[model samples]
Target: MPVDLETLYPKLVNLLLDPVFVVDESGNIVFVSDACESLLGYTASEMIGTLIFDYLHPDDRERTRAEANRVMTGHPHTNFENRYLHKDGHAVHILWSARWSEDDKLRIGLARNVTSLRRANQTRDALYRISEAAHGADSLRGICDGVRQVIAELFPRNDLHLAFYDPVRTVLTVPDWSVDRANDWVEGSMQPGTALAEVISLGQTLLASRDPSQPGLGVITESGLKSPGPLNWLGVPLISNDSVLGALVIESQSEHIRYCAADQELLQFVATQVAIVVERKRAEDHLRFLAHHDPLTGLTNRSLFYDRLETALKSAGRHNSLVALLYLDLNDFKQINDTLGHEAGDQLLIETARRLEQCTRETDTVARMGGDEFTVLLTDISDLAAVDAAVGKIREVMAVPMMQEGQIVLISFSVGVALYPQDGRTARHLLGSADSKMYEHKRRRQAG
Candidate 1:
């Protein structure tokens, strides 16, 4: 009634959860257990006589060879690890226990599929690194780059794209490193119907593959590289405090690589961390900007303008050049405010700031000193004539009619010009001279 030992041994090995392999000195797979079909998606008959090295992950081949040599030298390895490509083309992490059989002139090994365990460890490490990247990076772009790097490690042959939305300002911002961006893409508040836009607006994760039968994202190929097979694209919304702040999109760069539900979950976990850091950094940046900028007109404030004026004066002194300061006041600004209401008055001021910028060179400094008052520092001026010409350009631009509250209104401004060293050397002195000239011009307009 007892079974033969030879037949019973093979049956016991076949019933094992882990796959057993018998390889010759030439590294050919001479025999494999039935369980190998579950591990590598290959039947024993198909794998027999094939070179085991051909199935190894390219990056892990050299180290695996070294470990094989160690095992062949009678040093049996119980916990050796390597990666192999499954039949589906995704990498499968394997833990091996093997020994060289001298009598059989072959290497006998057992293979355990450790892919899930390895992925868990990798995900844990990746989350920690992403947290570091988010908080440690100096800017939003740096944070995005760091997140991309970490993701590339976890999911090989993939790229990450970041797009952030500010609900308060209604601006959509993508890092400069985004892949395959459209030619007309701009940073602003408007919503687009693109894939990434849908992810953000709908606050949902999207898993798309290239499907020839359907109209949506038929093929997920990036612009530069064409994958030989279908590429998977996964986008996860970055949610902060129940509001969608941005999206993190990952696309496969290789052939036949598809992202599954697990991949989406992992990316979402990391995205949560990214959203926290990005929001914190943006707030910090806004505060920093407000410290040196006029919130209403988005122009440089008095404090920063004073600093720049002093710096310009010193530079002019060094080069023996002239620097001019133009003080501007919106004539009858309060009268307009009283007549049209403060809302119309604010609109006029904002429009005035825009016109001032349009009339100046990029090198010139335009600032909002206070309500109805602005200053411009014109550096490296050749002579008084240059200053006069700049003032003329400003006056001409400001004279254009602006529609406020459905009413066409004509605006005017009075500018007082002061030259460094001529109007007095210091910032305070130059400012005083400009103020006096501005008041004198206002009085002259009144008398006329």
Candidate 2:
């Protein structure tokens, strides 16, 4: 058997990079290399004459032997990868090239280390996780949430701020934003030359490790709005369509890694993605706002009123409280439309809605039923006097004349109230009862 290889030229064996082994027809390891000691924790002398099947990872051995048998005919095959048991008891991923020998009594194979390549595959899988997570985020705030989640991988447990630019304000405006929020968000305006403003002003990324160069954020950290603060910070600007649209700002906790250049690069890439999402979200919000709100009065149109009414009804039912529906129709609505035209009539309706809203509590709802018609939902009522008091206040607010082309025109609303369970439980039933009551009041006043 070629003098058992060791008995022949044993010195030539240690030159290969792969863990080479010669197996006899009986599948025993007749010879091995010095590489075996480094790869498998077995010295060549100790492994020689051992079974080749014994050294293979037990789970892979049978399938590997089957594959080897299929390719036993001497043909140069290339590039296959698999795993094997390592010396430290961890599995080693290996790239393999194997072929059968001409002697028919033995076979040989070569392998290359592939651990780094495997780790890269794991990173690719993580990238897929980000894409899947970010897919549903189409608005600025939704985009903010997506960015918050991705950034969470680095900073994990800190809250972050998101702001977007307002073209009219020429400043960074609060985006759909939250504070460590699960679902709630607030959209509003913020002052210029503020903390986020500094980031947008720089027109570049800012990494604040020990101390930030931006005085706005630095001042806030040293001393907050109420008092001074000790927090260190980092801020990055989001750019889209060649302009800085906003800034994504994150603050570090005491134990955080010192924010570095690499961190800035990662943040920049994430912010770019976030900017695209926020832009789309704003467009969608504008469209949605237009669809559900009144173009003239800015009141909840019939559609939205009914939606809110249903929600209020369900909530009132749960609390075992009452819901009062008020239907107001202007007595002189047609006269204003006829004399001053629809423009004057529209102004009167808008002013009426404003006055009604002003008279109601935050929990109360005021809605425009249509031209010359308005509705109010007085919820969580403890007594009938609450309804009487609310109607009295609305009548007083509406009594004030609205200015129309330098003329003060008085508008009176004939208001009607319908109570839940006593008047009706259904929305349409409540509207019918309220409408009938309004006309009855109108007739009684007309006769008097």
Maximum-lDDT candidate: 1
Q: What is the TM-score of candidate 1?
A: 0.83
Worst 10 residues of 1 by lDDT: 211-220
Tens-digit lDDT track of model 1 for 1-448: 8879998999999999999999998899999999999987899999999999988877788998898888788999899998887776667889999999988989999999998898799789987898888778887778877987888888776766677787777777776653574432347563564556678778988765534342222243455875535446778899988999878877764445666665777888888888888788889999999999999999999999999999998898899999999999999999999999999999998999999999999999999999999999999899889999999999899999999888899988777888998997999999989988998999999999
Write the residue-wise lDDT of candidate 2 on 408-433 in tens digits.
Answer: 88878787899996998888888899
C-alpha lDDT of all candidate models, in order: 0.84, 0.69
What is the number of backbone collisions in each predicted candidate, taken in the order shown?
1, 8
Best by TM-score: 1
Per-residue lDDT, model 2, residue 113, is 70
lDDT of 2: 0.69
Q: Give the RMSD in angstroms, all C-alphas superposed, for model 2.
A: 12.9
